[model samples]
Target: MDVAAIVTAILARQAVRDPATLRPGMRLDDLGIDSLGRVEVVFAIEEQFDLSVPFNANTPDAGGFDLTSVGSVIAAVEALLGEGRG
Candidate 1:
Protein backbone atom coordinates (compact mmCIF):
# COMPACT_ATOMS: atom_id res chain seq x y z
CA MET A 1 0.00 0.00 0.00
CA ASP A 2 2.81 2.35 -0.78
CA VAL A 3 2.19 5.71 -2.37
CA ALA A 4 3.18 4.69 -5.87
CA ALA A 5 0.88 1.70 -5.85
CA ILE A 6 -1.92 3.79 -4.41
CA VAL A 7 -1.34 6.32 -7.15
CA THR A 8 -1.40 3.62 -9.78
CA ALA A 9 -4.68 2.27 -8.44
CA ILE A 10 -6.12 5.77 -8.43
CA LEU A 11 -5.17 6.38 -12.04
CA ALA A 12 -6.41 2.94 -12.99
CA ARG A 13 -9.67 3.55 -11.19
CA GLN A 14 -10.05 6.89 -12.94
CA ALA A 15 -9.26 5.32 -16.32
CA VAL A 16 -6.37 7.67 -16.68
CA ARG A 17 -3.02 6.75 -18.11
CA ASP A 18 -0.33 6.04 -15.61
CA PRO A 19 1.93 8.86 -16.59
CA ALA A 20 5.68 8.45 -16.74
CA THR A 21 5.86 10.21 -13.39
CA LEU A 22 3.89 11.93 -10.62
CA ARG A 23 4.54 14.09 -7.60
CA PRO A 24 2.88 16.07 -4.79
CA GLY A 25 2.59 19.48 -6.40
CA MET A 26 0.78 18.43 -9.57
CA ARG A 27 -2.74 19.88 -9.61
CA LEU A 28 -5.77 17.74 -10.32
CA ASP A 29 -6.94 20.22 -12.94
CA ASP A 30 -3.59 19.85 -14.62
CA LEU A 31 -4.31 16.14 -14.83
CA GLY A 32 -7.65 16.90 -16.49
CA ILE A 33 -9.67 15.78 -13.50
CA ASP A 34 -13.15 17.17 -13.09
CA SER A 35 -15.39 17.26 -10.01
CA LEU A 36 -17.00 13.90 -10.67
CA GLY A 37 -13.67 12.36 -11.38
CA ARG A 38 -12.39 13.61 -8.06
CA VAL A 39 -15.31 11.98 -6.27
CA GLU A 40 -14.59 8.69 -7.99
CA VAL A 41 -11.00 8.94 -6.90
CA VAL A 42 -12.14 9.50 -3.31
CA PHE A 43 -14.25 6.36 -3.42
CA ALA A 44 -11.42 4.37 -4.89
CA ILE A 45 -9.10 5.60 -2.20
CA GLU A 46 -11.60 4.73 0.53
CA GLU A 47 -11.87 1.19 -0.82
CA GLN A 48 -8.14 0.79 -1.23
CA PHE A 49 -7.14 2.24 2.10
CA ASP A 50 -10.15 1.15 4.11
CA LEU A 51 -10.63 4.61 5.49
CA SER A 52 -13.62 6.89 5.51
CA VAL A 53 -12.42 10.29 4.39
CA PRO A 54 -14.82 13.15 4.82
CA PHE A 55 -14.91 15.95 2.29
CA ASN A 56 -17.10 19.03 1.93
CA ALA A 57 -17.25 20.97 -1.29
CA ASN A 58 -18.50 24.00 0.58
CA THR A 59 -15.72 23.90 3.14
CA PRO A 60 -12.63 22.72 1.38
CA ASP A 61 -10.68 22.12 4.59
CA ALA A 62 -13.26 20.37 6.72
CA GLY A 63 -11.30 17.15 6.93
CA GLY A 64 -7.98 18.83 6.41
CA PHE A 65 -7.68 16.56 3.46
CA ASP A 66 -6.19 17.52 0.15
CA LEU A 67 -6.41 15.30 -2.87
CA THR A 68 -5.13 17.80 -5.33
CA SER A 69 -2.52 15.37 -6.63
CA VAL A 70 -1.38 11.79 -6.27
CA GLY A 71 1.26 12.83 -3.81
CA SER A 72 -1.12 14.96 -1.77
CA VAL A 73 -3.59 12.11 -1.61
CA ILE A 74 -0.83 9.81 -0.51
CA ALA A 75 0.20 12.26 2.14
CA ALA A 76 -3.35 12.49 3.45
CA VAL A 77 -3.61 8.72 3.63
CA GLU A 78 -0.34 8.52 5.47
CA ALA A 79 -1.41 11.19 7.89
CA LEU A 80 -4.66 9.42 8.64
CA LEU A 81 -2.87 6.17 9.29
CA GLY A 82 -0.42 7.90 11.54
CA GLU A 83 -3.23 9.43 13.55
CA GLY A 84 -4.86 6.06 14.02
CA ARG A 85 -1.64 4.81 15.55
CA GLY A 86 -1.59 7.54 18.18
Candidate 2:
Protein backbone atom coordinates (compact mmCIF):
# COMPACT_ATOMS: atom_id res chain seq x y z
CA MET A 1 0.00 0.00 0.00
CA ASP A 2 1.12 3.56 -0.66
CA VAL A 3 1.67 5.09 2.75
CA ALA A 4 1.47 8.71 1.63
CA ALA A 5 -1.67 8.17 -0.37
CA ILE A 6 -3.42 6.34 2.46
CA VAL A 7 -2.36 8.86 5.08
CA THR A 8 -3.43 11.78 2.91
CA ALA A 9 -6.77 10.16 2.20
CA ILE A 10 -7.44 9.61 5.88
CA LEU A 11 -6.46 13.18 6.73
CA ALA A 12 -8.55 14.58 3.93
CA ARG A 13 -11.59 12.66 5.14
CA GLN A 14 -11.09 13.87 8.69
CA ALA A 15 -10.41 17.48 7.69
CA VAL A 16 -12.89 17.60 4.82
CA ARG A 17 -10.19 18.96 2.56
CA ASP A 18 -9.04 18.08 -0.92
CA PRO A 19 -6.52 15.25 -0.91
CA ALA A 20 -4.61 16.91 -3.77
CA THR A 21 -4.01 19.94 -1.59
CA LEU A 22 -2.80 18.00 1.42
CA ARG A 23 0.99 18.19 1.37
CA PRO A 24 3.57 16.30 3.38
CA GLY A 25 4.68 19.41 5.22
CA MET A 26 1.19 20.43 6.28
CA ARG A 27 0.52 20.08 9.97
CA LEU A 28 -2.58 18.28 11.21
CA ASP A 29 -3.74 21.33 13.18
CA ASP A 30 -3.38 23.51 10.10
CA LEU A 31 -5.85 21.21 8.37
CA GLY A 32 -8.35 21.78 11.22
CA ILE A 33 -7.86 18.26 12.64
CA ASP A 34 -8.56 18.47 16.35
CA SER A 35 -7.92 15.78 18.94
CA LEU A 36 -11.03 13.87 17.96
CA GLY A 37 -10.14 14.04 14.31
CA ARG A 38 -6.64 12.86 15.11
CA VAL A 39 -8.02 9.87 16.96
CA GLU A 40 -10.15 9.07 13.96
CA VAL A 41 -7.11 9.30 11.71
CA VAL A 42 -5.21 6.89 13.93
CA PHE A 43 -8.07 4.46 13.89
CA ALA A 44 -8.40 4.62 10.12
CA ILE A 45 -4.69 4.10 9.68
CA GLU A 46 -4.69 1.08 11.97
CA GLU A 47 -7.62 -0.42 10.16
CA GLN A 48 -6.30 0.32 6.69
CA PHE A 49 -2.81 -1.01 7.29
CA ASP A 50 -3.86 -3.78 9.65
CA LEU A 51 -1.18 -2.58 12.06
CA SER A 52 -1.50 -0.95 15.44
CA VAL A 53 -0.40 2.66 15.78
CA PRO A 54 1.21 3.80 18.99
CA PHE A 55 -0.97 6.80 19.61
CA ASN A 56 -2.49 8.32 22.71
CA ALA A 57 -5.17 10.97 22.20
CA ASN A 58 -4.57 12.49 25.63
CA THR A 59 -0.78 12.65 25.28
CA PRO A 60 0.11 12.39 21.62
CA ASP A 61 3.79 13.10 22.15
CA ALA A 62 4.15 10.41 24.76
CA GLY A 63 4.10 7.80 22.02
CA GLY A 64 7.23 7.26 19.94
CA PHE A 65 5.20 7.48 16.78
CA ASP A 66 5.51 10.88 15.16
CA LEU A 67 2.31 12.79 14.33
CA THR A 68 3.81 16.18 13.68
CA SER A 69 3.17 16.36 9.94
CA VAL A 70 1.79 14.41 7.02
CA GLY A 71 5.25 13.27 6.01
CA SER A 72 6.03 12.19 9.54
CA VAL A 73 2.88 10.12 9.68
CA ILE A 74 3.79 8.39 6.44
CA ALA A 75 7.26 7.77 7.73
CA ALA A 76 6.01 6.42 11.02
CA VAL A 77 3.67 4.01 9.34
CA GLU A 78 6.41 2.86 7.02
CA ALA A 79 8.66 2.31 10.00
CA LEU A 80 6.02 0.30 11.82
CA LEU A 81 5.47 -1.87 8.75
CA GLY A 82 9.20 -2.41 8.39
CA GLU A 83 9.38 -3.48 12.02
CA GLY A 84 6.65 -6.01 11.50
CA ARG A 85 8.63 -7.65 8.72
CA GLY A 86 11.70 -8.16 10.86
Candidate 3:
Protein backbone atom coordinates (compact mmCIF):
# COMPACT_ATOMS: atom_id res chain seq x y z
CA MET A 1 0.00 0.00 0.00
CA ASP A 2 1.20 3.53 -0.72
CA VAL A 3 2.38 5.17 2.49
CA ALA A 4 0.78 8.57 2.00
CA ALA A 5 -2.42 7.07 0.71
CA ILE A 6 -2.75 4.70 3.63
CA VAL A 7 -2.07 7.41 6.14
CA THR A 8 -4.44 9.79 4.43
CA ALA A 9 -7.18 7.20 4.36
CA ILE A 10 -6.83 6.52 8.06
CA LEU A 11 -6.81 10.22 8.80
CA ALA A 12 -9.91 10.76 6.75
CA ARG A 13 -11.66 7.99 8.61
CA GLN A 14 -10.69 9.22 12.05
CA ALA A 15 -11.13 12.93 11.55
CA VAL A 16 -13.94 14.27 13.74
CA ARG A 17 -15.14 17.31 11.85
CA ASP A 18 -13.50 17.71 8.47
CA PRO A 19 -12.00 14.82 6.59
CA ALA A 20 -11.75 16.89 3.41
CA THR A 21 -9.53 19.35 5.21
CA LEU A 22 -6.71 16.85 5.37
CA ARG A 23 -3.51 17.91 3.70
CA PRO A 24 0.13 16.85 3.75
CA GLY A 25 1.37 19.82 5.77
CA MET A 26 -1.76 20.28 7.85
CA ARG A 27 -1.44 19.72 11.59
CA LEU A 28 -3.54 17.00 13.22
CA ASP A 29 -5.45 19.49 15.33
CA ASP A 30 -6.10 21.72 12.35
CA LEU A 31 -7.51 18.71 10.54
CA GLY A 32 -10.06 18.19 13.32
CA ILE A 33 -8.46 15.12 14.89
CA ASP A 34 -8.74 14.96 18.63
CA SER A 35 -6.76 12.80 21.06
CA LEU A 36 -9.14 9.86 20.68
CA GLY A 37 -8.98 10.21 16.93
CA ARG A 38 -5.20 10.13 17.04
CA VAL A 39 -5.19 6.83 18.85
CA GLU A 40 -7.75 5.42 16.47
CA VAL A 41 -5.65 6.53 13.53
CA VAL A 42 -2.62 4.71 14.89
CA PHE A 43 -4.63 1.55 15.52
CA ALA A 44 -6.01 1.66 12.00
CA ILE A 45 -2.53 2.06 10.56
CA GLU A 46 -1.27 -0.88 12.55
CA GLU A 47 -4.16 -3.02 11.39
CA GLN A 48 -3.88 -1.93 7.77
CA PHE A 49 -0.10 -2.37 7.46
CA ASP A 50 0.06 -5.35 9.81
CA LEU A 51 2.94 -3.65 11.56
CA SER A 52 3.35 -2.26 15.01
CA VAL A 53 3.55 1.50 15.36
CA PRO A 54 5.60 2.92 18.21
CA PHE A 55 2.96 5.09 19.75
CA ASN A 56 2.02 6.40 23.20
CA ALA A 57 -1.45 7.82 23.06
CA ASN A 58 -1.37 9.09 26.61
CA THR A 59 2.03 10.67 26.09
CA PRO A 60 2.54 11.07 22.39
CA ASP A 61 5.80 12.99 22.71
CA ALA A 62 7.38 9.97 24.32
CA GLY A 63 6.79 7.77 21.30
CA GLY A 64 8.71 7.40 18.06
CA PHE A 65 5.63 7.73 15.85
CA ASP A 66 4.79 11.18 14.56
CA LEU A 67 1.18 12.27 15.03
CA THR A 68 1.87 15.88 14.20
CA SER A 69 0.82 16.19 10.59
CA VAL A 70 -0.29 14.06 7.65
CA GLY A 71 3.20 14.35 6.18
CA SER A 72 4.73 13.24 9.44
CA VAL A 73 2.55 10.13 9.59
CA ILE A 74 3.42 9.37 5.98
CA ALA A 75 7.11 9.81 6.74
CA ALA A 76 7.00 7.55 9.78
CA VAL A 77 5.15 4.83 7.87
CA GLU A 78 7.65 5.10 5.02
CA ALA A 79 10.51 4.68 7.44
CA LEU A 80 8.90 1.62 9.00
CA LEU A 81 8.16 0.08 5.61
CA GLY A 82 11.76 0.69 4.57
CA GLU A 83 12.79 -1.34 7.60
CA GLY A 84 10.63 -4.18 6.29
CA ARG A 85 8.05 -3.84 9.01
CA GLY A 86 5.15 -3.60 6.59
Candidate 4:
Protein backbone atom coordinates (compact mmCIF):
# COMPACT_ATOMS: atom_id res chain seq x y z
CA MET A 1 0.00 0.00 0.00
CA ASP A 2 0.98 3.60 -0.52
CA VAL A 3 1.93 5.96 2.28
CA ALA A 4 -1.45 7.59 2.55
CA ALA A 5 -3.27 4.28 2.69
CA ILE A 6 -0.87 2.93 5.26
CA VAL A 7 -1.29 6.10 7.29
CA THR A 8 -5.05 5.96 7.06
CA ALA A 9 -5.07 2.34 8.13
CA ILE A 10 -2.77 3.13 11.02
CA LEU A 11 -5.05 5.87 12.29
CA ALA A 12 -8.09 3.67 11.80
CA ARG A 13 -6.60 0.79 13.71
CA GLN A 14 -5.78 3.12 16.56
CA ALA A 15 -9.32 4.51 16.53
CA VAL A 16 -7.83 7.93 15.97
CA ARG A 17 -10.02 10.66 14.60
CA ASP A 18 -10.36 10.47 10.82
CA PRO A 19 -7.22 11.49 9.00
CA ALA A 20 -9.42 13.54 6.70
CA THR A 21 -9.87 15.76 9.71
CA LEU A 22 -6.16 16.22 10.25
CA ARG A 23 -3.72 18.79 8.90
CA PRO A 24 0.07 18.91 8.68
CA GLY A 25 0.70 21.07 11.73
CA MET A 26 -1.69 19.36 14.09
CA ARG A 27 -0.28 18.06 17.37
CA LEU A 28 -0.29 14.41 18.46
CA ASP A 29 -1.83 15.38 21.79
CA ASP A 30 -4.71 16.94 19.89
CA LEU A 31 -5.35 13.53 18.35
CA GLY A 32 -5.16 11.77 21.72
CA ILE A 33 -2.15 9.65 20.73
CA ASP A 34 0.35 9.12 23.51
CA SER A 35 3.95 8.00 23.10
CA LEU A 36 2.93 4.37 22.94
CA GLY A 37 0.54 5.15 20.12
CA ARG A 38 3.33 6.93 18.30
CA VAL A 39 5.52 3.82 18.59
CA GLU A 40 2.68 1.67 17.35
CA VAL A 41 2.28 3.92 14.34
CA VAL A 42 6.00 3.69 13.67
CA PHE A 43 5.96 -0.10 13.85
CA ALA A 44 2.93 -0.26 11.58
CA ILE A 45 4.64 1.94 9.02
CA GLU A 46 7.75 -0.24 9.12
CA GLU A 47 5.64 -3.33 8.54
CA GLN A 48 3.61 -1.64 5.82
CA PHE A 49 6.64 -0.65 3.78
CA ASP A 50 8.98 -3.36 4.99
CA LEU A 51 11.48 -0.74 6.05
CA SER A 52 13.31 -0.54 9.33
CA VAL A 53 13.43 2.91 10.96
CA PRO A 54 16.18 3.67 13.38
CA PHE A 55 15.08 4.87 16.79
CA ASN A 56 16.33 5.81 20.22
CA ALA A 57 14.94 7.71 23.21
CA ASN A 58 15.64 10.89 21.30
CA THR A 59 14.48 9.60 17.94
CA PRO A 60 11.19 11.41 17.85
CA ASP A 61 12.85 14.67 18.76
CA ALA A 62 15.04 14.29 15.68
CA GLY A 63 13.97 15.21 12.20
CA GLY A 64 11.44 13.20 10.15
CA PHE A 65 10.48 10.89 12.97
CA ASP A 66 7.90 13.20 14.44
CA LEU A 67 4.39 11.77 14.33
CA THR A 68 2.57 14.89 15.41
CA SER A 69 0.31 14.74 12.39
CA VAL A 70 -0.82 12.33 9.73
CA GLY A 71 0.79 14.36 6.97
CA SER A 72 4.05 14.46 8.89
CA VAL A 73 3.94 10.72 9.37
CA ILE A 74 3.29 10.18 5.67
CA ALA A 75 6.13 12.49 4.73
CA ALA A 76 8.47 10.72 7.15
CA VAL A 77 7.53 7.32 5.74
CA GLU A 78 8.03 8.58 2.19
CA ALA A 79 11.47 9.87 3.10
CA LEU A 80 12.42 6.58 4.75
CA LEU A 81 11.24 4.64 1.69
CA GLY A 82 13.26 6.91 -0.55
CA GLU A 83 16.33 6.36 1.58
CA GLY A 84 15.85 2.58 1.49
CA ARG A 85 15.40 2.57 -2.30
CA GLY A 86 18.48 4.74 -2.75
Off by over 4 Å in 2: none
lDDT of model 2 at residue 39?
88
lDDT of each: 0.72, 0.89, 0.83, 0.71
* Number of the predicted model whose TM-score against the real structure is largest: 2
Predictions: Cα RMSD each:
2.1, 0.9, 2.2, 2.3
lDDT of 1 by residue, 1-86 (tens): 47567765685457476555555677777777777787888787778778777876666567788867767777887888777778
TM-score of 4: 0.76
User: Between the candidate structures 3 and 4, which one is better when assessed by lDDT?
Assistant: 3
Write one digit per residue (lDDT tens) for candidate 2, span 1-86: 67889888998988898899999999988989888888888899999999999898778999888887898888999999999998
- lDDT computed for candidate 2: 0.89
lDDT per residue (tens digit) for residues 1-86 in model 3? 66787788788877753445678998899777889888888889899998888888777978788889999999988898888844
State in Å the error of residue 23, model 4: 4.7
Residue-wise C-alpha lDDT for candidate 4, range 17-55, written one tens digit per residue:
665666667666767778887777777877878888765
TM-score of each: 0.78, 0.93, 0.85, 0.76
Evaluated with lDDT, which candidate comes out highest?
2
Itemize residue pairs with steric clashes in candidate 3.
none
lDDT winner, 1 or 2: 2
Q: Which candidate would rank higher by lDDT, 2 or 4?
A: 2
Q: Which 10 consecutive residues of model 2 have the lowest summed lDDT?
A: 56-65
Error of 4 at 33 (Å): 0.8
